[model samples]
Target chain A: MQFDVRLFALYRERAGASIVTIDLPEGASAGDLTAAVRADYPRLAPPEVRIVVAVNAEYADDDQLLQPGDEVCLIPPVSGGC
Target chain B: MIILTDEPLDPVAVTDSVRRDGNGAVVTFLGTTRDNFGGKEVTRLEYEAYDVMAIKKLQEVRDTLRADYGIEDIAIAHRTGRVDVGHISLVVAVASPHRVQAFEACHEAVNRIKTIVPIWKKEWFADGSRWVACEDHEFADEAEHAHAHAERHAVAAGD
Candidate 1:
């Protein structure tokens, strides 16, 4: 399965693109996508930092199964509130 | 009212939008761009967001506040794009029957928005710029500098 993972903030700048397409297995979970993104873009963030995955605009657990057309984005640490 | 806008946020209008006859207390919080950050002079701040998700998260924050504090009146407005120094970037207004609940709920709403909302800020200094809390390339260096500066300030105070 091919999934287009949306990147934001630092991830977007490091990757130099807003979206990156990756190929995964049929039953790949959200964790799998994270791993794949890390593998593809080593400079995106440090290994220790967790790359949060959001599906359909909500934070998804590691085990959440990603559908074909779900809105997937990588969220970095945020600093945007009053 | 929950809004993600590029235009300047009107605090008065946002506060008015949440006003009700039954509400006795209204608390409004505004987050503005500061000129200094960690000993560096910030020229301006730029914001970006995953718009669709940001709106959803703002709604979630409002709903959670109402559920937890029993405060039904809430309004949040956040700005995207460039915000100059000392300009308003965020406004959160809460109304409730009592002052305590309104204050508490408003505080919590800001905290929650910081954690969950899909918004990012970039601090532009005269020398360069870096995203706030990106935790990627520049954040580590900036963190160390901030820590060192803080320690220096503490030592100066002790002297």
Candidate 2:
């Protein structure tokens, strides 16, 4: 299956593209998508920071199963202004 | 009311929208772009958001506050794109029968927006620019802050 994942903020700036298409096997989980994104774009790797996955506009757990055509996003740490 | 605009925000309009004759207190919060950060002279601020998700999350904040505080009149407005220093970037307004709930809800509203909403802010300095709160340590700090906020909220709610 092909998933077109959306990127924003620092991730978008690092990836140099707003959207990237990833090829993943069917029945892949949201966690798998995150791994795939990092694998595809090595520059997106931030080992210390936890990048969250949002499936269809809601935060999705790692184990949550992904379906085709679902809106996926890579959410970086929000601006809390610490 | 939930608003996401690239244009400059009007706090008075948002506050007035939630005002009513029966309400005794109306609390408003305006988050402005500061002129400096960490002793670095800041030039401007640029905000970005996942628009659709941002609106949904903002509405969720309003709905949750209404349910928890029994306050129905609430409004939130956030600016997107370029916002210069001293400009308004966020506005949260809440009206209630008393001052306590109004103030608490308004405070909680801003916290919730910072945590859940998909808005991002970039700080521009004369030397360069940096994305605020993108660091790993900052995330950890925010988590701790959120934990503290949650505990305070629970205590305030008597939960």
Cα lDDT for residue B76, model 1?
A: 97
Kindly report the interface RMSD of candidate 1, rounded to 1 decimal: 9.8
Q: List the residue pairs that clash in candidate 2.
A: none
A29-79 in candidate 2: lDDT tens per residue? 988998898888877744433458889999887788999999999876676
TM-score to true structure, per model: 0.89, 0.88
Give the Cα-based TM-score of candidate 1 against the true structure.
Answer: 0.89
Residue A81 in model 2: shift from native, Å? Answer: 8.6
Best by TM-score: 1
RMSD value for candidate 1:
6.7
What's the CA error at residue B122 for candidate 2, in Å? 0.2
Badly placed stretches (over 4 Å) of model 2 are: A80-82, B134-159
- Top candidate when judged by lDDT against the true structure: 1
For model 2, what is the alpha-carbon lDDT of residue B110?
A: 87
lDDT of 1 at B34: 89
